[model samples]
Target: MKVVKRLIGQRCLGIEINARGELMGLQVLVDKKDNVVLGEELTGMNEIQAFLDEHPLTPIALSVSSDEIIYSRTDQQLDDQSMSDLLRQEVPSFDPEDFLICYLDGFYGFARKEAISEHTSALSAYADQVVLLGFGPIPAYNLALTLREETSDRLTVGSYQFDLNDTDVQEITPQDLEVGGLTVAAHQVPAFLVAIGYFQGGLGMMGYPFAKNDENLWYGMLLNKLWKPVLFSILALLMVNSALFLHFNSLNQELNEQSVLMQNLSDRRATLASYIEQNRQIARLGERESAFAIISDQIGATVPAAVTMEQLVLSPQSADRRAESAYQKEKVLLQGITTDLKAFSLWVNRLEGMPWVSRVASQKLTETNGVTRFELALIRHVEES
Candidate 1:
């Protein structure tokens, strides 16, 4: 509260038309601690305007003469239409439109539009805002409440006076109280109290809203009202965005980590596939070696005493081709020297009759001296269906 008061740095120039028909003005300055510092009273409009010119930024509160203002108190709230009807009925001499009405805390104050205009115009040039404080000791009552001062049965302001018989009574003397370290007299209480209340920002409840003269000041008040909430909303949005960014950032990092893990698994899978293929190749070669051994043993056993074996080729490559001899994977080529042709023919027939032999075809036959050089293809036999 102190910091807020300091930031506002409010100064109120309270100009009251006292009961004595004298225009009295007092300027009250409220410190950061809400202490009231009162200025000496100025007697006329000239003096008040001069003081206002010196402090052009201050707000003014005009307390019109009690005779010119109509006030009423109620125990319940009244809407604008109801209040308007009441004001018209009470002051039948003038229309409700001619009066500026203000209601607060069950208290209503009505002032003639002309009277307010005349008072505000005199000081409007020097002040930013002007408020009607209305008639009576209401301002004084609020100030006394703020100071926690004991209430008296009666309170007076200049020639105007009012009785507080309905209020809870306390028998303390008004002289015993000290306001802002200054001793105040009983008669000066009303004016000084009003000024103090205005300075302390306590007059907002009782001030007449229609009395505020400047549009710029109203806009400024609106800005002050909207400022804090807007700032808080912006800050909240920034915090939400920051939190979302962090959450997504973490998710992205986790996804990257998962991708790396998947890549490693894929690489391992490829290596495993390569090893499996190599193992299959080796197993096929082992089966081929076993088949080659079995076939070579059968061929050697079929050889007769007259035939001397020279060379044998199984599944010979294309490079070993002889004239008119085409290579077949299932055929075995045999080359030998045979002294007796009949024995060689019987040997071929014997080999062909074997269960594993498909058929035997004679590829080449040559003779050199008494020895015979021959080439034969021994095709394996197939069983009849």
Candidate 2:
């Protein structure tokens, strides 16, 4: 309610006839811009386009000269029946069809239909969606809602303020509110605020299409004419959303199919890996068996005549490993019991000295009741160089 009651004015486009009664310039008041452009500048539609270029899609209130309109306040707050009777008695010259009549209960505004049509047609050429078309200087009494001798309704233009009503009831002068530049001057702001009370100023308007029949209620500006476009917009939005949903659903299905295919490929890869490991083990065992015979003959030649050996064993160092040769590497194990520790040491040193031996160590070395029981292993050497 405060939004309506505050007497605010937005961008207003004012039109008027010249002194010669020819279609004249347009006065543009945009957002109370203090730098108001006046006569001769808006000679054509150029000014209107220029204003719109700067302030696009701004709501425009049209203010015409007050001489073009007839405004009055009745003695009593008239009902429709009383209003018709009063209008008939007061203004018998007015034909309802020749003129457009717009009124609140007490305040009324009327203009000739032919003249308004001409003004509107010219305005429609220059602008769009003209919301409020009224006489420029609006009545303060209408907004105040009462006529008091002490109270006054005044509208300021360039250097002067005009009286909307003579003594009691008032109407705003329809002088175009002029706003010139992008930056409005501070002193020129007050007049625009006053014009606000008149533009969408809650006064009854003759030509404005979307004004309320009774008051400035929110729904008053929205006529029954607006329903079809709003309905079509909603329907169009729903259709777009449905199309997008179908598209994304198909994409999701494709993604799921690709995911399943990937999982199958991963399982196949694991099976192939296991098969390769089994082949590696079989190849390593073949190499170990083939090398066992050669290693046994070499062990027989290396052993001293003084030592006896048992539990002779030879095996490849890694069964699961792949090798380029049948006799890649092997570990040799031998056991013996000897009374001479010095002779055992000499034999161990000889085993280490062999080029095939990587390392030599005893797995078990035990002496009991003057006899020594021992084990030794010689691992095959592998050098990159």
Candidate 3:
């Protein structure tokens, strides 16, 4: 014999299979997130499997029975008569006692508004969560209140009201709020906000089934799958980037310190050079002053009383050791004339033999009517006596 499963309303639907893999029954669940079901049916399993294979159902947990499969659809576009017809066609030969049927028509137009409302009210007694999905303003809004009132303390209803006139879904009201109970907190807004946010940004919404019994896929399964790894990777990259930035900053600081040190060294070198040049200039000036003083003293000491100098000139020569030794000694040239030749010759001998003087040379003596004229060159020792 073929097994059967049946489900009622737009809640989550599931099938329960026996140990032999034969279909036992079907459960129509109200709470999709928690895996809570409203009602179930038992019928032929083989026929239900064949029907499901032909018209694929959304993947969800199921509660199977002896001979039936139970399920529900939230898409309100399916009309009541059409839904009834489809169920008949799907389970062609099912016993009335073995079949249970229910549906949610919140998304349907105003034509099936009464029928959908009646069905929702009837199912609220047993269902754990009832969802009202719709586009219009009036019927959808009305259904929201009705689900809340009917479910009361027993069940929670999530009203997903899509505004057909407006391009976006304006507001989502949780079922727990309308019944004066503790609603899902605002922190839970992120997941719902993200889903709606994507819809607003032009990405369509895709539903994934989550089972309450299965701990892994329960809370924000779809969101966790997509965002957890990505968030972790980004955090890790930011940490690595921060470390690298700090390393480069340290290196730059070190380079700046080295640059300052080099500049300081260069400044010290330039200062030393300036000091050396100044010292050389001071030494040269001192030597020049000493030489002038010595020459003045010698000229005074060698002057004779009868030989008055007519003109005296002193000129300095280059101090080249090699040239001075090879040729003649460098001296200061003194040009002059005197009235007496003998007196001038005596003065020349005294100037040549002076202690500070190295040597003295004279041009040939010339006497013109008792006026003796001659030039004398005196070489002074550069070293101290």
After superposition, which runs of candidate 2 have C-alpha atoms over 4 Å from their true positions?
Answer: 1-223, 290-293, 313-331, 337-350, 363-372, 383-385
Query: What is the lDDT of every predicted structure here?
Result: 0.63, 0.54, 0.43
Point out where model 1 deviates above 4 Å.
1-61, 66-93, 101-110, 122-132, 136-152, 157-160, 164-192, 195-254, 257-261, 264-268, 291-385
lDDT at position 250, candidate 3: 96
Backbone collision tally, model 2: 15
Which digits, one per residue and each the tens of the lDDT, describe model 3 over residues 266-310? 999999999987987688567656666777776876787776655
Q: Residues 245-303, candidate 2: write the lDDT tens digits.
A: 99999999999999999999999999999998798779767866766777677767777
Error of 3 at 39 (Å): 26
Q: Best by TM-score, which number?
A: 1
- Model 1, range 1-385, lDDT digits (tens) per residue? 3344456655566777654556777676666566767666677878877776665545667665556666666655566766776666777675666776655434566778677666555555654467446455456545544443444646443333334434332323334236546766554555566566555453433224434543444345445756898999999999999999999999999999999999999999999999997987687568547767887788888799999988887766566567323445567888889999999889888887888777776657798998888898877643221
Instruction: Note the clash tally of each candidate.
Output: 4, 15, 40
Against the true structure, candidate 3 has what lDDT? Answer: 0.43
